[model samples]
Target: MVLQDLGRRINAAVNDMTRSNNLDEKAFDDMIKEICAALLSADVNVRLVGTLRKSIKASVNFASLPAAVNKKRLIQKTVFDELVKLVDPHADSFRPKKGRSNVIMFVGLQGAGKTTTCTKLARHYQTRGFKTALVCADTFRAGAFDQLKQNATKAKIPYYGSLTQTDPAVVAAEGVAKFKKERFDIIIVDTSGRHRQEEELFTEMTQIQTAVTPDQTILVLDSTIGQSAEAQSSAFKATADFGAIIITKTDGHAAGGGAISAVAATNTPIIFLGTGEHMMDLERFEPRAFVQKLLGMGDVAGLVEHVQAITKDSAGAKETYKHIAEGIYTLRDFRENITSIMKMGPLSKLSGMIPGLSNMTQGLDDEDGSLKLRRMIYIFDSMTAAELDGDGKNFVEQPSRMVRIAHGSGTTVREVEDVLSQHRMMAGMAKRVGGQKKQMQRAQNMMKGGNKDQMAAMQKRMASMGGAGGMGGMGGMPGMPDMAKMMQMMGGGQGGGGMPNLGGMDLQSMMSQMSGLMGGMGGGGGGGGGGRGRGGR
Candidate 1:
C-alpha cells in the first residue's frame, strides 16, 4: 500500500470522468486538482507536482483531436503519459552485461537499509545465472563485516571482507581485485554509512569510489523518510556520480511517492525497490507500471512475467504447467498451485498485476485475505497422508472427514467444504479439457527460458497449441485442431487425403477464424460437430 491513497484518489477522479457524457474544462481542471492534491498529500515535491500538472494540461489539445476520438480517453492518455514522465525523469540506467565483472557500489546513510539492499541486488543477478559476489567495505560501522558475512553465507554467495582491515578504501580495492581475478560476473561492494551526512563520511565515500572505480554507483534511500528525501538524495547525488537509485523499504511506506519523485528529480533512475526483508522481495522499477499500479490500473504483463519466472524456476514447475494446461489437475495439484502462487508474492501484489482486479483485491494484504489463505494452508497441512493420496478423491466420498480436518486446522467445517468445493471446480475444468496433452506440452515449452514479451509469448503458446485442424474428432480438448475436418478440407473430400499442413500459421488468429466458421455452420453435420462448434470459441 505504498501509494494506496494517491492511487485511490487518482482512480476515483478518472472513474468520475469516465462516467461523464462530456468533459468540460472545469471537470478537467477539477481532475488535475485532485491529482495534484493526491501527490501533495503523498509528500511529493511541489515543483515537480506543478510540472506534472503543466505537462498533462499541455498534452491535451481538444482542437487537434478528430471528432471520432474520445475527449475523456485523450485526457486519460495524457495523464498516464505525463505520470510516466513525472517519475521517470528520462534518466539513463546502467545495464549489467552477462559474463562480465561489473562492479557496483552501494552508498547511503545509516538506517537506509543499504547493506541489505546490496545482498538483494546480488541475489537478483545471482538467481538469473550470474556468478555474483559480495564485498563488505563498511569498515566505518560496527559489525558491518559480520552482517554482510551473515547475509552472504545465507544466500550462499561468496564474499570478500576482513575484520582487521579498518580502511574501507583498502578493503574495496582488494575485494574488487580478488573478484576480478576470479572472473565473477557481478561484484557488489557494500560501503559504510553515517547516521547523518558529514564531510568526513562524504569524503570517505568519495575515496572508496576512487579506489574501486565502480562501474556503477547506486544511491540507496529509505522511502519512509518522507519529504526529507529531496535533501538526502541531493546529498548523495552531489557526492557520487550516482548511476542509479535503489529505494528501500517501499513495501509499507506511505511516503514512497515522495522519496521516489525526489530521487528521480536528480535524474537518477530507480533500478529496483526493496519491498520486503527477503532478497527476492526486490522488484525491478518500471515507471509506467508504477503509476499504473498507483492508479489502480493493474500491471498484467508484470503479473504474467512473475508467474513464468516463479513457476519456471520452481521444482516440478514444468510438470505443474503441463498438468494445468492439459486439464489433468487434482486437489493435490490445486494445493501445489496455491503454494506456487504464494511463492510469487502476496495475493494483493499479484492481484495488482491483473486489470480490473486491483480494486476488488485492495485489502487482500490485510487480515481478511491473508487469514483466508492461512486457513486454507492449515487445512491442507492437517489432511492425512491417505486422505490427500492420489488426486485427493478420498475427500469427495467422506463428509465427516472434513469436520475432522476443520477441527485439526482450527477452522469451521464450512471452510473445509469451501476448500473441497474449490477442488471440485478444478477437477471439472481438468475433465473439460482432457486429451490435449500434445498441445499443452508445446505451450509449456514455448513459455520456458526467455525474457521476451510476456503477452506475445502467451499468444504464441495459445496459437501454437491451437495448431492445425478445425473443430472435429478432438472432443473438448483446449486448443485442439480438428484433424478430420482439416484432412477432409485438404483433400477436398477425396481419397488419399489427410490433415492439412498449415505450416507456420499463426494459430491464435486461425483459431478465431475457425471459431467463427464453426459458429456459422450452426450445428451442421453431427452431434460431435455441434460439440466442436460450441467448444471452438
Candidate 2:
C-alpha cells in the first residue's frame, strides 16, 4: 500500500512540477529527495534508494529538454526506468530446460509461506498442462507434510514426502525419483524452514541441493521482515545457490519493497510473489507492472493479459477489441462480454490485480461476489443464441422472457437487467473507440519505451504452454494484439460487437437469437473460453 501511495505522490509531483517553465536544479533535487524519502520510509534499502535517486537525476533533466516536451512524462518515464532497474537489474526470465525435469528447490525460514508458495508454483504449471509434482522435503517441521499434501491434492499434482522421514536429503531424493519415474515435466522440492541456529538443517539443505542439482533454487522470504531480509538472504546465499526469491505476504503492509529492492543487493532475481494464502495467489513477477503499481499508474501487463485471455477465439473478441480501440463497441458485444467474463474466475479476483483496487473490493464477500458473477453469466447464457449475438430488438418483445431467464439462471430478473445495462454501457464505450489496434500499439510502445531491451531479451524464451506458442514465449504470451488478446480473454475481458436493440425484447426471443449465434458459430464447443479467434485460427 505504501508503494502504491508513493507511486501516486511521485506521479503527482512530476505532473504538477512539469507545468512550471522555471525548472531549477533545486526542484529536481527536491523531487528526488521526496522519492528517496518515500522509498526509504516504505522499507526500501537505504543504499538502493540513494543509487536510484542518483540514476533518476542523471536520466531526467528538465532544464536541458525543449520547451515543447512534457516534463511530467519525462520524469514519469525516468521514475519508471529507475524502479524497473531497482526491481530487476538483470530481468531474468525463467526457462525450464529441455529434455529434463527442471528441479526447483524452495528454501526459507518458518512462516515465510513456503508451503503455500510451492503449491502455487505447482498450480501455475498444472494449469498450463505441465506434468508437475510437489515434493515435501521439509521433514523437520511437524504438519508441514500435511499442509503441502493438502495443497498438492487441491491442485491434483503428484506429491511425495513422509510424515516421519528424518532425513530431509533422502526424502528429497526419493521425491525426485518418484517424479522422475512418473516422467513429470518438473519437480519442485519444498525444503524445511530452518532457523538461524538450526545449523544441521541448513547443512542438510546443501546436500539436498547437491542430490537434486536443481535448475532453480529459490529463497522464500516473508516480506514483513524488511531489513532482516538482507541478513537472511546473505546467510542463505552462503549455504545454497539461490537463483531467485519469492517474497511472501506482499498483499499486506509487509514492506515487500525492501525485500524486492534489496534483491539486487542479495544477487537474486525476485521471481514470484506470494500475495495470499491460497494456492492460486502467487503471481509471476513482472518488473514493469511492479514499477507501475509502485508509481500508482496501474499494471499494464495485468490489464493486457486479462484482456487477451478473455477475448481468445470468440467471434467478436478481436473485432470488439478493434472496435473498442476505434470507439465503436456495441450492445451485443456487451452481452458477450458477460459470457467472456464468466469464462474467467471472478471479477473481484481479477480486480485485485489493478493498483489500489484492494480497498475498493474489500466489501466483496467471496460467496456473494462469485454468486453474482455466476448468476449474471447464466442469465446471459439462458438467453436465445440470437439475443446473445444480436440486439434486444431481435429477441422476444415480452417481459415474460426476462422472468423465464431469471428462473432458468436461478437469479432475479433485476440481476439479468443489470447485466443487460452493463452491456449497454460497455457497448457504448467500445463504439466510441473505433479500433483497438492503435490503442494496443500505444500500449506496446509505452511498454517498449519503459522496458524495451529487457522485454526483448525475455521474448527469446521458449514457449511454456507448448511448442511454437505458449506461456514461455517471451513472458506470458507472444506476438502483439492477438497473443495479447488471447492472454486478456483467458485472463478475462468484455468482447466487441453491436447487439440488436434489447430495450424491450422478451427473454425467449433473446434466448432463441443467442441459440442461433451459438449454432452458427459451431456452438456447444466445450473448449475453455481462452484461445485464438479472429485471424488467429
Candidate 3:
C-alpha cells in the first residue's frame, strides 16, 4: 500500500477499536495487530514493526488504566506517538547560519534523484533568504553537468560545473572554493552516484568529501528501495558518513514508510521529503507534523508557514484583508487569493495540510487542480474592470455578461456562474463577520507578538467563532461539507488550536474557501487538452 493508504488503514484500525462497544483488551490487541500488518505491508522492517507494536501495547496498558481515564484518547495518542517514534531520529540536523558558507554535499546511488534534489534544496534555502548556489561535481555520468545546469538555471540558482574536469574531487573543490570566496551561505555540491556501492564509488565519495569538507552530507535515498534502505544507508554511512538523508520519489512509492523507518533506525536525521517533481515540493520533514498530516489530521503549522512565506509581502492580500474588514469581497480580491494559492504550491499537497479538504480533493491530482485554478484566472482576466472591482452583482443583473465572459474566457456560462456563486458566498461571509475587526486586529497583534498564551487565546477565539457567523455559513459552499466541524477538528474549538489566524481569517478558512470555489468550477474534473482560452483578451 502507498503511504496514504497505509495511513488510512492505521487510522481505520484506531477508529474501529475506539468505536467498538467492547473497547476491551481484545479490541486493543486487534487494533495493534491491524496497525502492525499495515506497516509491514508498507515494507516497514519486521523488527522495527515489532518494536513499534510492543511500544504501543506498553503505552496503552488497557488492564492497568484507571477507569476515569479517557481510554479512546489515550489509545489514539499512543498510536500517533509510536508512529512518530518510528520516523523521529531525535537528532538535530545541521543548520546553516546566515552570512557564512555552509557547504552541503549530496551522495546517493544512481537514479536516486541526487541532482534534482540538489537543485530543490538549493532553491529551498534560496527562497528562505539564503545566498544559495549549486556545484555539480558528478563527472562520472554523461550529461550530468547539463542536467544540473538545466535545473539550476530554471530555479535561477547560480551553479558551477565543468565540461572538461573529469575528476569529481577537483571539480568539487574548485566549486566550493569559488562559492566560499563569494560568501555563499549554502553551497550544495552534487556528486556522481554509481549503480551499486562499489569500491570506486566509495573512493570517489570520500575524495569529494575531503575536498569540500561539507558541513552537512545528505544521502538522497530512493524511497522505492523499500526495506533495502537500511542496508543502503548503513553502507553509505560507513563510507561517506552522511549526517542527514533526503528520501526522493516518496510521492510515487508505497515503500516510503520502509525507507523512512529504516533511515530513522540508523539515527540519521531526515531533513526534507521530496513530495513531488516540482521545485516547491521539498517539504521540511518534522516527525510530528509528518505523522499528523499522514493520518489526515492536517499540518496547520506547515500550512501557516507556507501561507506566511508566500504572502509576507503581498499587498493584494493586505488590501483584501482591509476590504473584508469593511464587508467587501470583490472578484479582484478572489483573483488575488487564487494567485497566492497558486504560488503556495500544488493544490493536492496543500489540501493534505488541511484537515477536511484532503478528503474533498481525494481524486484530484496536481495537474488537474492547477488547470482548474488557471481557468478561474482566465475567467478573471477576461472580465471588465468594473466587473472585477465591484461585487459580482453586475453579472447577475445582466445574464448576457456571463455569456460574454464565457465566450471570452473559453469556458462555459455555467462555469462563470459558478465563479459568481462562489464570490457571493465569500462576500456574504465577509459581510457577516465584518463587525469583528477589533477582534481580528487583536488576533493579528497576538500573532505578531509570538507569545504562546496570546496565540492560544487567539486560537480559542477563532475556534469559538466556528459555530458563529465566522465559518458556519461556509458549510453550504461546494466541497465544504461542514466548515465548523472541520475547524473544530483543526483544534479551533479546543484550547490547543493549531490554525493560525492571519489578518482576520485563518489559513484553513482561506483554503476551504478556495477549495469550495475551485470545486464549483469543476476542479475535480479532468484537464482540458487545448490551451486555456485567452481569445477575448
Query: Between the candidate structures 2 and 3, which one is better when assessed by lDDT?
Result: 3
Reference-based TM-score of each model: 0.78, 0.69, 0.84
lDDT of 3 by residue, 292-369 (tens): 988999887777666655665577876776676677789998898788888877777787788777777777767877
CA lDDT, every model vs. true structure = 0.69, 0.64, 0.79
Worst lDDT run of 10 residues, candidate 3, spans 475-484
Candidate 1 lDDT score at position 192: 84
Q: TM-score of predicted model 3?
A: 0.84
> Which 10 consecutive residues of model 1 have the lowest summed lDDT?
528-537
> Residue-wise lDDT of candidate 1 within 443-495, one digit each (tens)?
44544544357536555554554554433323332322343343233222431
lDDT of 2 at 270: 84
Clashing pairs in 3: 463-492
Which prediction has the highest TM-score against the true structure? Answer: 3
- The prediction achieving the highest lDDT against the true structure is 3
Error of 2 at 227 (Å): 1.5
